[model samples]
Target chain A: MELASSNYIETIGFIAAFLTTAAFLPQVFKTWKTKDVSGLSFSMLLMFFVGVFLWLVYGYYKESPSMIMANTITLGSAFLLIYFKITYRKK
Target chain B: MELASSNYIETIGFIAAFLTTAAFLPQVFKTWKTKDVSGLSFSMLLMFFVGVFLWLVYGYYKESPSMIMANTITLGSAFLLIYFKITYRKK
Candidate 1:
């Protein structure tokens, strides 16, 4: 790809990264507020958390800013969900 | 980064991508079987679907097989979630 086109694609990737990763915030907030995680699948959260961590490592290796930033934020959200899954389940 | 190191990182990225994307399967299966979407957020699904679509485009541009494969699977899962959210909610 041409340099200019490559830059454009990177821009698109960044936007996509932001949207997908940030999409987790509402779930975290809702669970935090309602303390309701009855609907969440624990296996999914656990698996996703591990996946995000590896993605962070991959981001560092690849030196992609969007991947790094997105995965960091996503890791936070995934962690919150896991926490909610553990804590809210007891209640 | 050295080419060998970059290749290793991409391998890691593919593994992460597979785990994260495949993580959605359980939710989709559960929802399909039980049709329970009460815990799912519509906005999140919508946002994520769009994000995944863009990621697909990004994958094509960047020539990342992992991104393409992962986003394609993720997009399907996201779409199913959205469909379940719509169809199962009425009952």
Candidate 2:
């Protein structure tokens, strides 16, 4: 029973991780394609980058495979957005 | 020894939670202040909302206080952003 319950929780975590991490892709694609960053908040991207980085560290220390996987992908996406925000800003 | 290490992990989680949740504020503020939806991706906001909502459910099932708190706040913010995107798009 306990094992089954834990498995259920892991499934939920995995789905949650997948959704949240994949959520950033559209923004990345839109920003990349449009190169219109007027609406993007620099501070938000910076803070999110730092926060996701911390989450990555937290996941590592917690030994959570899902958290680690989610945050790693999220960290990369956040980095890409940050780069987009800067690189496209002057154009 | 284990307790101390666990506490340290908790501290990291707490900070990560605070940062990730708080990171949405500037975007909210910028959107509210400028009423700019051009740079905001509707698809991204929608996906983020669903993802955060799922994270909330996962947090509840996992009994993770930090996860619950962070996702709750993020969910609210994501919802607000979506609202802004829809409401301001026609303007």
Give the top-scoring candidate (TM-score): 1
Predicted candidate 2 versus true structure: per-residue lDDT over A1-91, tens digit per residue: 3433767776777788888888777878888898988767888788888989887887777656778889999899889988988898974
Query: In order, what DockQ does each candidate have?
Result: 0.67, 0.58
TM-score per prediction, in order, is: 0.88, 0.83
**Model 1 stretches with alpha carbons more than 4 Å out:** A1-4
The DockQ score of candidate 1 comes to: 0.67
In lDDT terms, which candidate is top? 1
lDDT of each: 0.83, 0.81
lDDT of 1 by residue, A1-91 (tens): 3534667877887999988987878888998999988878898888899999898887676666777888899999999899889988964
Query: What local lDDT score does residue A65 receive in model 1, on the 0 to 100 scale?
Result: 76
Tell me which residue pairs clash in candidate 2.
none
Per-prediction fnat: 0.76, 0.72
Residue-wise C-alpha lDDT for candidate 1, range B21-82, written one tens digit per residue: 87878878988999878777888888889988998887777666777888899898899899
Error of 2 at A43 (Å): 3.6
Q: Model 2, stretches more than 4 Å misplaced?
A: A1-4, A89-91, B1-4
- Scored against the true structure, residue B40 in model 2 reaches a CA lDDT of 73
Q: Which TM-score value belongs to model 2?
A: 0.83
